[model samples]
Target: MNHPLLDQFNQWLQQFEQTGSVIDTTRLNEWNHLMDQFQTHPEQLSSNHAQWIKTLAQNSKAMMSVVEALQDQATDSSEQLKKLREELHQFNVQLLLQQASLPQQMAPLLFTHTHLSTLFNEEQLAKFEQLKSSLNTPQFEKLNQLIESFMQWQQAGQTLTEEMNQITELATQTWQEQFDDSLSAKDQIELWGKIYDNTYQVQFQEPSMQLAQSGWLNGWADLKLAWKQLLTQLTEQAGLPSPEQLDRMIEQLDQQRRRIRQLEKRLSALESGDHNG
Candidate 1:
């Protein structure tokens, strides 16, 4: 929209149309003269034209960086979630093996029934069922509830991770297709701007985006809460603090340390005043 050179060219076109046909020698000569002036003295272009192009390139790079960051976040979350799931799976396997070997002695532990079922072949399940009667009824019920809660958390985490990955892919594809270094700076800026606007709407305001937003954001929050619950239960069983509890303790300790430092400074100032007095 702000292409000064294009605007001048358009003005020349209008003059040519008004003054004479393209075949007119006089009009052609005038056009040639204009071109000669532009070619001989590039200063005819705005002084800040190069600066404008640089700014446009910088803006484009910044936008690409945002997409890259989002992609990285999605990738990190997916990997972290995968690792957490693997750890939880391994723990479940160990617990199942222990219970199957000595059901009467083993304490009840929560495991996602569906996921646990998948791990066991029919033979293993049949083998494990021999000790089912030995399970504490009340503890079994608690474990069932815990497993259900964990499943909800797992579902949310999966949904969020999937949606994040999908969006990142779409953004990356759009950026690549629209980006063109060969285009003139002004054309490039305009093209990139249009692409950005359309891409933004498609990526953020479309039905897919709306659904992702609703599901992923809330799912992530719910997963965090569920993780805390699971962590708390695990910590209690292990006679150790949950990560959340440890984090809170660390935060409180930091605050107290800062307060102590402030108080020490105040006490030092009072002593200095007293000595002066």
Candidate 2:
């Protein structure tokens, strides 16, 4: 059984050989074995490949959902920030009004000799003047400055949230465009590849996108770690090997197999040398 892909691979291998390009024998052998398996069991290989592709499509759909979720989160954050800014402004206005009315409200307590005498002595009355002076000058100014700083901070936050919303919206739109139902599987895969490349470029170029990407990657990493831990615990409870343990076992087996292959190659070389001798 001949495959066009295998024929193309053979052509490339022949070209590499004619060009005297170095190729890893182990990798070449692996490719040859895989091709041989595909040739021998075309139906089984095709079925498996189709299943793998289906899995990829499912993953891509899941990714689309994640992107949409991110967009919703960003929009929610922007709205929340806008609401907070409005509340902050209202609070600042109320605070300033309270601060302005404080002197009038305390006038009798500070200046009325009869009321002052009931509350404190002459020394305490004198200190009240200082308190009034401080509040009227430095404290009032400081409160205004603090409110201004808070407003500035809120503005910065609003700007950041807006940028995040825009980026997420663009990403969502791009993904939706790529995931056309009319597109074939191969075209969808190619479009996804292009999306990845474009996203990679944009992430580097846009600082906001880079920050968003970093946060997303960190969140995903934490989620993956938590999932793995859960899996490990579940597997332990079931008296089965965890994925990490199985992976380590596979790695050790591969190393042992590689060592055996190397020994066999050396023995074959020695045998050939002896025959020549």
Candidate 1: which pairs clash?
Answer: none
| Candidate 2 accuracy as TM-score | 0.29
**lDDT of each residue in 132-219, candidate 2, tens digit only:** 4556664254333333332333233344444444544454458666568798867975886576457546755887756644544444
Top candidate (TM-score): 1
RMSD for each of the candidates:
21.0, 28.9
Regions of candidate 1 where Cα sits further than 4 Å from its true position = 1-198, 201-211, 244-248, 271-277
**lDDT per residue as tens, model 1, 1-277:** 3755547667878987786534355655655555544444444464546555445445555554444444445657565445434433444344433332312211144322322332334464444454354554764544444444334433443444454455444544565577676888579658755654565566676676576556645543554455466557667779997877888999999999999999999999999999999
TM-score of every model?
A: 0.32, 0.29
